[model samples]
Target: MEPDNAERDPLPKTPDPLADWLEEPGSTAPGRSSWLPILAIVVCVALLSGAAYALVKLRKHPAPGSGLTAGQTALASPGSAWARDFPVSTKADLDGVCRGWYYPQSPAATGPAPHPITVTVLDNAFKMRLQPLSVHVPDGVKKQFRDAWQPADLAKVQIVACVDLVGSGKPLGKCSFTSPKVTTVPFVEGIYQITAYEVATGRKLTEARVIGAEECPLVALVPADDVLHSEVSDRQLYDKLHALVER
Candidate 1:
């Protein structure tokens, strides 16, 4: 047995091992170590946010001198509301009003004579009967339509069979002709695509349709007259016409 004086010397007052380890730069407390992962996450998130911002900025300014027209730009800028608001159709939408008329242009002193135009497109409702506008054509050539049809009747027809003028489906939206005499423009009528939009949302709503009879030439098949100013916008409709007369 040790003497009382030999009682175990007081244990040296050493620092806690855990506390010492924490004080070293190489070591960390459990709580503090957890903060490292959290901080790294925050940094990563900030970087991602910055990259997204840069991407958006790049879109706001397209490449300089891209040669994009205003219409093209309006279509290309999907980041803006205009793209959503003013969507254009790549196809001739059948959702709008359509009208068409055919007339003979009297052959000039030298040009090819126009005649015998074939009727291609007929309203799905009933094949519209084409009567010779001329009295010289025999009555036997007159074939009765299953249903009476008129320009006013186009609204009632649902589907319009459009055979492309070039035999290839292409937009024939504008028409102009020139001669030695004063230039005259005629309105070609058929299948005018009418696009309608929603007022509130600026969203395209439906394709409304307009059908009508175009003015015809007199019995002499006179030269086209100066189209009235009011009809100028409609001159663009010359493209939608399918020739019903083969000549």
Candidate 2:
């Protein structure tokens, strides 16, 4: 007979519910509730990560139509209507020249519009080779005014022009220009598709597809300095725009 004080086999060891649940495979019942907190934490972490990534991307690359930076002006015109369509195009009169279009059938200026007209150059090309030419463009354009309107008219007239690469991704050839030194290391190539607009009326004044070599590209309109003058094709573009306004 066993002694009364003798310890009997510990009452069949009591099963621990937590231990059993942990051991079970895919136990959804009561155990599922425990996973809720962990799942929520994971989901929150993923959402936060996504939000941060988006914020960084936006800061790095500002979206289109957001606004302009310093030294930049708006490109769009007030009224969206085009003044008139100058469909007639011209080719390079001389060999080794670029070709394009200018508005106004006549070389003369229509008259004079309000001073301080805005001109926007839209560069729709893969590469931005026309940037430098854009800087000197105002001088050339102003010269066109003088020629069309006259030297006295230049004082009264003002031209504010800016260049913008709209990222058209257009594949084009080279656009060469003759300089004083000529055959220099510093040179730019590629076909540049440029569109000039009169910002006030939103008129599509002139479009140029310059190829091969040119005399001062569009800068030729300015006769000052030792730089070469623009070819007939290039000059016509500016002249035509002035003609539109002179009207």
Best by lDDT: 2
Off by over 4 Å in 1: 1-31, 66-247
Would you list the C-alpha lDDT of every candidate in the order shown?
0.30, 0.34
What are the clash counts of all predictions, listed in order? Answer: 23, 10
lDDT of 1 at 121: 31
TM-score of each: 0.21, 0.26
Candidate 1 local lDDT, 1-247, one digit each (tens): 7568556788689756456335656566465444665789999999999999986664442223433333333321243222112221211221221122110111111123222111123222233322222222223333322121112232222222232111112232433444344434443443433332221111222333444333433212222343311111222222222122111
Q: Give me the overall lDDT of model 1.
A: 0.30
For candidate 2, the 10 contiguous residues with the lowest summed lDDT are: 91-100
Native-to-model Cα distance after best TM-score fit, residue 168 in candidate 1, in Å: 24
